[model samples]
Target: MSDLATCLNGDLLCTEDATRLEEEEDDDEDDRFVFLMSRSAASDSEEYIRFLFSRERSFGDFGHAGGGDSLMRARSAAVRWILQARIRLRFSLQCAYVSVTYLDRFLLRRTIDSNQPWIMDLLSLACLSLAAKMEEIKVPPLPQFPAKNNYHGKSVLRMELLVLNTLEWRMSQATPFVFLGFFAYKLAGELASKELLRRAVDFIFAAIEGTNLVDFRPSAVAAAAIFAASGSPPTEKSMNQGMPIIESPELDQILSCYEIMIQAGASPGVGVKRKRLHLSNGSDL
Candidate 1:
């Protein structure tokens, strides 16, 4: 093994005192996170939509997988930090996704210091902090992160700055959440229930645990999540009904992503669980 990979094969998976963060919020927080996007989408021309997908394509060319298993575990560990924060803080899943988007983009461009596993913990916390500032209705203070002896304020600030600079200060990430509503409506109509959207969100959070989803564009991942949530393959007519609903050229890609999510998210004697996610289509559910 390379020095980088060898340094990572230790017990840095998680800290023991994970659930100590005490945060409380009301049911009303969900209202603030409704999908404010236009379902008609008349405002977005085809060119603009294509531009969004193209940008995702450009952003997803992760060319830094030289470290094999240890590196993959490191990445997964960092994302789990975000998940732990989300569960403890009861923040919007959008916040979690934004954190992950920044983490993925940052890791794509910057190398983690192999000797400093705690740096992954700090980076994960910093990414979550940045995303909460962006998406949470009430951002929590960094003190809520259950910091160890080493996580000082200045260190976190430095790490946050490093993440911003690494991503060139561009934070308008096009995550799969951006396309969940549009793709679900386009492909499934009313069949895409409140229950279905909930499952899709679970699939997304579960599927994004590691690099299994690295190659997919956000839209493709969104479509695949919809399929995985439906708990069955899309019908031939449903899949072929229109312009961008998993067109023939991209059907295989969506299918491949679907299998990945099922494998990545499956549990024994149980299906995917629902998270606190809801997608509104400017109409009644």
Candidate 2:
């Protein structure tokens, strides 16, 4: 309770708060310099990175936390809806990420999901179309999704305007991939162990798969998952082992819930097969 109270009181700074303000300023300078250098390089890769970083900075300026985990919240269902729709429709991962951003931004303005799974595909395509217009030099034609579903072109165009109006014409977008990568790197510093870093990466990716699950809180789930996988304890660490060991039952519960949510959000299209080549093999189904 003391730790929680301290965290609530703002006296307990997360890793970032402990850093000197000067150092934080230096880091910002470094990010700016990197963007500038990349722009001078003038390659497609640089352009894409520039676009992402621009969007990230805009999110930060607008009080949106700039982390992949921030994009995931226990109370928010829209991100998961977009994610699930992308999976079901077999949309590219990059496109899915773009759609998730679009969906999140839209939710900032309007109520979303309302526990309805059926309308998700419609919302997902609309979000992706909006993202395509913003991110693509030439927007890709909306592909005919499936035999059973034919989204009206007029409907899509209408929804695009609705989304734009909902977002108040603020079109900057940021995906979680960059922030996730940075968070992993920072955790490596905190743990100072290669094995811990590997485990953290594994945990982040696993929790990311659960972005579709409503109960999964991105930042808390991410921190807890990484803490569990790294065998690290908060506010304490073994001198023998570099990484902190979070060996608490409460932490266990959080990690278990994360896994449960991921399983629940599992797409029906993919199945884990348990088959054996020999006669002694287990049931395939």
Candidate 3:
């Protein structure tokens, strides 16, 4: 097995080996930062925006197969489980966002048997595990994952393989979080605080619960969240007052997405019942 696979399976490491792993992780972070910067630059291009819009349309037709309501319920449950795992594992919000992207994309292509709700939980666990491995310096052993679904470590590993195959190994997904920093910088300039960024991220997470918002591009969604959290209307004067004037297609898209968020009950101060799946094992999905 690869060293990463061995570590994920709970193998013991010597002190020197651990130190070496830490150094490797630091290098990986540097590489990741470079890649993210490149992606952020590309995302501003018309070609990249078109690609994201096309991909959104492809995935938007999901949740209509094999009992629509059941599928949505399952998806909602998986999202909740992912959220809980993020908290318990102390994972970054970016990790959770990428995992949710994987889960949604997988469900878009693969149909789950709704009668077997455990399948959804297994998928959620696999996605979360993959996200942790991608975004975290040190991931917990597979066996250490939440055991509510009675899923064995082997099951999670198998499901992880399936998810990887289903996603065509496109693990580094472009989520709203990827564009968040850029948008926040554009909106708040040097005045952006950790609290403001956190609130915007929370708004994005809440909006993710809205099925209608799934069709929006991640960039547009990120832009809308920042706009809403800033408490500024998307007017010509307001948007261009002290900031770079967002014009034409980009501005229109963000405003449109914000409107959708409002209609879907993702507006600030709006409370919508997030869908949940209640299975026999007291495990979500």
Candidate 4:
């Protein structure tokens, strides 16, 4: 609803409008997901944070050094699709974030051959569908997700299981958004205004969409986003508690991420959102 979202087509695209942006999805063949036992909803526990930061730090440079731009391009395209679904189907941005996490983890483990674009599209849809199921109650049937290729419900379910096994059922993970509030108040306290948080969300989303902040931990990105948004990092003096968010040893990492966040302000993955909304009413930024 702001100038940035309207101008950049951020996370504000309406459901009806988003549908108009793509072809109507085909009906999935009547196929039930096997071993699709109901799982616990996503929680921000220690394990979640561990899964996001601990497991992998070797995903590559997101470039052709792995081979070519094909993988990177596919990854970027999948993010766009997830964003569009988040806007259209009214899923929380957190769900989109989780979906992207699934996509990235899966891609890292099994690099999709450049020749198989359909695999990318299918996997993207499955990942988004699984995320919506995790983060929202009114998730549509698997066939409902718009995609370039018409995927069977069974196929999507298979991909979901593959993703699940590969991720070790890490349906929950910490994200940059989780620490935005903590850092804002830690740094600005009573003076923390909505503007500071808004700017930080914009910055975090932009960095996630590009290759700017992927290698850093979520806390680092959150601290860096606040630093980038409000003009400085949280100092030891600013901390009202035991440890500063960015310790002296970790200060270098935060600054590096902050520099990238500033450069990636206008990055393609920009998704400016005003509401700290939930998954149900949709549009979490």
Candidate 5:
């Protein structure tokens, strides 16, 4: 099985396991959960972080000479539209994330004429369709996709082929969602209810809408989302309360990324001030 599948199905506790684990002794379960968090944290080394950064860099057109602002606006608009459509269709958050990744990467490499705005919609359709296929178990047929956008099935297919080629068939690129389950588990431990994780995932989706957040690594974003969702102040007591403290290197990295999100005006207001305090103290947590 793919790493994502393994993480989602086994390490992160599928539905059955979650229900079963709830019945286990609290202390024993907390110990086991701590062990899993340690293992996950240990695996996320500097090299691993660099690898994710490099992979993200490989996608998305960060630098385009002239008309860059306009391009970003168009891209942002398309992303918003795609996200709304995904919600309407009841697609998974993963599908929206992957589709945006594909769309940005495609736009980075392939320039679209600003006058031909309809092509952007077509591209969004193609990317979203491909993402749905990748992440959804019961993907709607291409013909059945919403027609309000006026995308023809044949054109979408052609764009999909082009995107597949451009990405070198790498549809399973690492995304923030990939790290969410692990981080959420680390933050809440056995107490990490599905609702908490869902809120964190929701924050992630919200963060993705910010074009300024494009440069941050997915792992960092995942960590920040968890931090924001936990409602735990970044202070020493808050950070260490109810769970194992997030140690240095990792803690610093997540704080830096979270600050960036805050500066971009993208973070939820729940823990923003407390995070600033934690940053000021440089406390280990």
Candidate 6:
């Protein structure tokens, strides 16, 4: 054998040091740290964290890998459903969007059988509570997630702690929907008749609802919402192409969603009857 081999076989080398190094490597491999870790382990964890936050998953695009359907179409349908259903009160669309975002983040770490729909409700409530806490200082202490058979506020309160823990306290406050609402009104313009403006808002709400389906780019949702609310009937050909493209397919889908909103009694109505606020200033009067 070579001279080095001969030295290693003879007791001329530090065998104890080699054995100790091997033992140390094995120990590191076997360690199960909760959070704290050695340098190598910490590096691995940091890589994982980076992966988690890397690409923001959009629910509108979730099912694209599974079929021929475009991501935009599914998202469009979902947005329509949310707006039509009126799932949350006040700016609930904003709540829904934030909740959906949280659900997307959670799903990256945990996979669920897509067949189980109740998980959607759980995630939705978790998002709502998180957003509410962030949005309102005097928010309801706990979420009021509705029960299957009862509307007891107590039942929703009981589940609050569990939901909070599951979310790990990451609740986003801003949503594209809220911003889109203002944009839609502005685009309809002061010159537009009241009926025209109201119709535009109705369509915009439908587009906002569309965001719920497939993973859609928020910008595209904004465009689709605007297109739908523009007081123009969307053609079926446009809807097929889907939002951001503004083709026939997309227009069709928007129109269909609008029809669904109307059938579901979600069409925007005349502003709530309100006594006109009388300012002390007599400039207008």
List the candidates ranked by TM-score, beginning with the highest.
1, 4, 3, 5, 2, 6
For model 4, residues 236-279, the per-residue Cα lDDT tens digits are 45432512524465565677778778887734224543334233
**What digit string (tens of lDDT, one per residue) describes model 3 on residues 1-285?**
432233234422222211110101122222333234334532355455456556644644333223388778888888877766665565666777778878877776677777767677778888999999998888988656663455556667877887888778877656676566566666676675444454565577666654433355676777787777777756655556533434445667678767655554434322111233343678431
- Give the number of the best model, judged by lDDT: 1
Show model 6 residue runs off by greater than 4 Å: 1-93, 104-110, 114-118, 149-174, 178-201, 204-214, 233-266, 269-285
| Per-residue lDDT of model 6, residues 1-285, tens digit only | 432122223222222222110101111111111012112221333233223223223222233223223433433333333222223233333444554555444444334343433333333444455555555444443322331122233333333444455446544423333233333433443332323323433443433433333344343344344444563444544433322223343344445455544443324431111122233574210
- CA lDDT of every candidate: 0.64, 0.41, 0.60, 0.59, 0.57, 0.36
Write the candidate numbers in order of decreasing lDDT.
Answer: 1, 3, 4, 5, 2, 6
Clashing pairs in 3: none
TM-score of each: 0.74, 0.43, 0.65, 0.69, 0.62, 0.42
Provide the lDDT at 154 for model 2: 57
Off by over 4 Å in 2: 1-94, 112-120, 133-140, 146-148, 189-285
lDDT of 1 at 191: 52
**What is the Cα-based lDDT of residue 257 in candidate 2?**
46
Spell out the clash pairs found in candidate 4.
Answer: none
RMSD of each: 5.9, 18.1, 12.9, 12.3, 14.3, 22.5
Q: How many pairs of residues collide in each model?
A: 0, 9, 0, 0, 0, 35
User: What would you estimate as the lDDT of candidate 1?
Assistant: 0.64
Cand. 3 TM to true fold:
0.65
How does candidate 1 fare on TM-score?
Answer: 0.74
Better of 1 and 4 by TM-score: 1
Q: What lDDT, from 0 to 1, does candidate 3 have?
A: 0.60
Q: Whole-model lDDT for model 2 versus the true structure?
A: 0.41
